[model samples]
Target: MMRRAAFALLAAALLGPLPALAQDAPLRIEITEGVVRPMPVALRFEDAGGAGELLGDITAVIADDLNGTGLFEMTEPESSPATGFDRTVDYIAWKATGTEALVTGQVALEGDSVMLRFRLFDVFAGQPLGDGMQFVSPREGWRRAAHKIADQIYARITGETPYFDSRIAFIGESGPATERVKRVGVMDYDGAGVKWLTSKDDLVLSPRFSPDGQTVLYTSFASGVPQIMSLDVETVTSTALTRDPRAMSFAPRFSPDGKWIAFSRESSGNTDIWIMEVANPSFAKPITLGPAIDTAPSWSPDGRHIVFESDRSGSSQLYVMRADGSEPTRISFGDGGGSYGEPAWSPRGDRIAFTRQTKAGSSIGVMRPDGSGEQLLSEGGRDSGPSWAPNGRVLIFTRLTADDEVPQLHSVDITGRNMRPVALNDAASDPAWGPLLP
Candidate 1:
């Protein structure tokens, strides 16, 4: 009976009216072109129903998900007060800890499922920022529940699209560079729950996720030549999309609506951009002709244009052209005049990410649609193959250094801050981020 009363009081406190300061100007982080300071936040969670390890794991995952973004810094748990789930927050005490935001949650077990109740508070304003919420899922889905909670908090504070609940498809690489073996795999965005989709018998690269996240398009060298193949993510079965033995097709990318596919095909030692109806792969047609090794066709967000790399000007450069092979124009003109390749269109259609190679080394960069405001986001160390996150604010790319030639996946913010290596058991590359789950 006492527990019931405490819960009621806590709920009332969460629903209380916010202060005028909060109503007018709530706590927010406007991510601009400048550097951003990490927001100090405190997290408090209690195991209300003897959840044991499950509760602890859920809490840790939530904290890591938020901290991994390099936006939130968790306060030292020892320095925080012993505020349990049943008590109201002491805003003054929390503010004294130098924490601007606070998150309180409770975990309980009910039958075969786990229930999580959480609330976000703006400590400076001494009021709750948003409504309290509850999430119920099976024990196996605890990580997903934690990600959902992180996404909610991130969206509410940063006013950006949430990417915590998405997945990434990549190539798992092993063995020496002389005899490397690669397989296709998919994992949660944070590198958990990895599942291999293909065997190492055949080499695979560039795993592209379909818009619906139900299929993955990749390049396979199973038949002694690189060809495009589509795999059903659920069944782990693959089917060849490019069957013509006369031409080699690779670098397959799905259109926004999944109705068409854009890829690169090499026939008679000449490469060009091609598009085919996804419903009928046998009717492939060339979108660009007389190409100077044109490849890596990435569709714009609206599917009206494509960005590719070509050497028509006697040097490799980025180009933007219509989807129907018309009016190709050069866009990239970096300061030092380097070669750009592997262009990936941002999901927001505002920027195009690519790899810039020069005399020093290769670096990952992004530019506007018209090739303006080019910014290098990664340091020069053979960085290449950039793939945008679902939110378009972050990108994952492959980085290889002179000392450590082994390729590894790394993520960076669009502003070139918070660069960090992705946690993986082996060398990985060609990261393709999938859409947020339902």
Candidate 2:
């Protein structure tokens, strides 16, 4: 009965208007184009129904997810008040601990399922900021449940879309640079729970996740020549999309609807972009033509257009054309006299990311679709294969160190801040950020 009363009170408090803090502004974080301070938040979870190890694992995953984003620095559990599902949070105590927000939860184990109930509070307002929520899932889905919880908190606090529940497909690299072994692999967005989808016997490149996140499009060299292959992410099975023994196909990418695939087909010493029905490769046809090489096609979020790179203009530059290969127009005009390629359209339809190469240096950069607002994300490196995260706020690409020539996956915020190597289960490149999991 006491637990029921506490929950009711908490819900009622959340529905009521919260008073602004004495400091005049509600304690909230505003993320922008600047160095992140990592807001300090406290986690206070208790195993109400003896959810032993599961509860602890979930707590750790939640913390790690938030920290990985470089947004929130968790307060030491010992320093924060130990509040639980049935107890009211002492906002004063949390404030004293330098925590602006507090999250408390209760985990109950019920047979093969775990139930979690959590609440977030604005410490200074001394009121529940959001309504309490509950999530239940089977034992195998504990990590996903934890990610869902983190996503909710992240969205509530930052007022932005959350990518915590997303996955990444990339080219896993091992062995020496001279004979690097590359395979397609999948992992959680934060680089945990890695699973291989292809073998190292094949040289893999451009591992792109399908729109539904159930399959991936990649190029492999197992047949002595590069060909685009679609791999089922769940079954670990694959089928060749362009199996012409005489032609080499690569740089495969999926349309937003997953009904069609765009790839580069090299035949008779010339390469051009082609779009084919994914279910029936017989419908394959060229979208771009002529003596120039047109490849690395990225679909706009709406799937009406494709942005790619071509060397028809005497140098590698970015271009855009309709999905059906009509009305080709060059978008990039040699940004300060450098070659640009590997263009990736932002998911938000606001920008296109590309690799800038010149005699001076190479870097990863983005620009408006019409070739304006050019911004470089990396200072200097052999950064290539730019792929946008689900939210389009960040990008993951491969960077080859100038000194070692070893390729590694790196992520950079769209604002050109926080360029860093992504933590991975293994060395990786040609990363394709997938949409958020269902």
TM-score of each: 0.90, 0.87
Q: Give one digit per residue, the lDDT tens place, for model 1 in 1-438.
A: 577656556655776634423434546779669746788888888887968887789888888888988999888745686676668988888888889889899998878888998999998999888998899999788888899999999988999989999899999999988889999999999989999999989989899999999999999999988999999999999999998888999999999999999999999999999999999998999988894899999999999999999998888899999989898989998997899999999999999999999998999999998999999997658899999999999999998857757888899999998899888887899999999888
Separate clash counts for every candidate: 0, 0
In model 1, what are the clashing residue pairs, if there are any? none
Instruction: Please give the RMSD to the true structure for each candidate, in Å.
Output: 8.8, 8.2
Per-residue lDDT tens digits for candidate 2, residues 327-386, read 888888864789889899998999999999977678899999888899888866678888
lDDT for model 2 comes to 0.85
CA lDDT of each candidate?
Answer: 0.90, 0.85
Candidate 1 runs further than 4 Å off: 1-35, 77-79
Candidate 1 local lDDT, residue 432: 95
Poorest stretch of ten by lDDT in candidate 2: 17-26
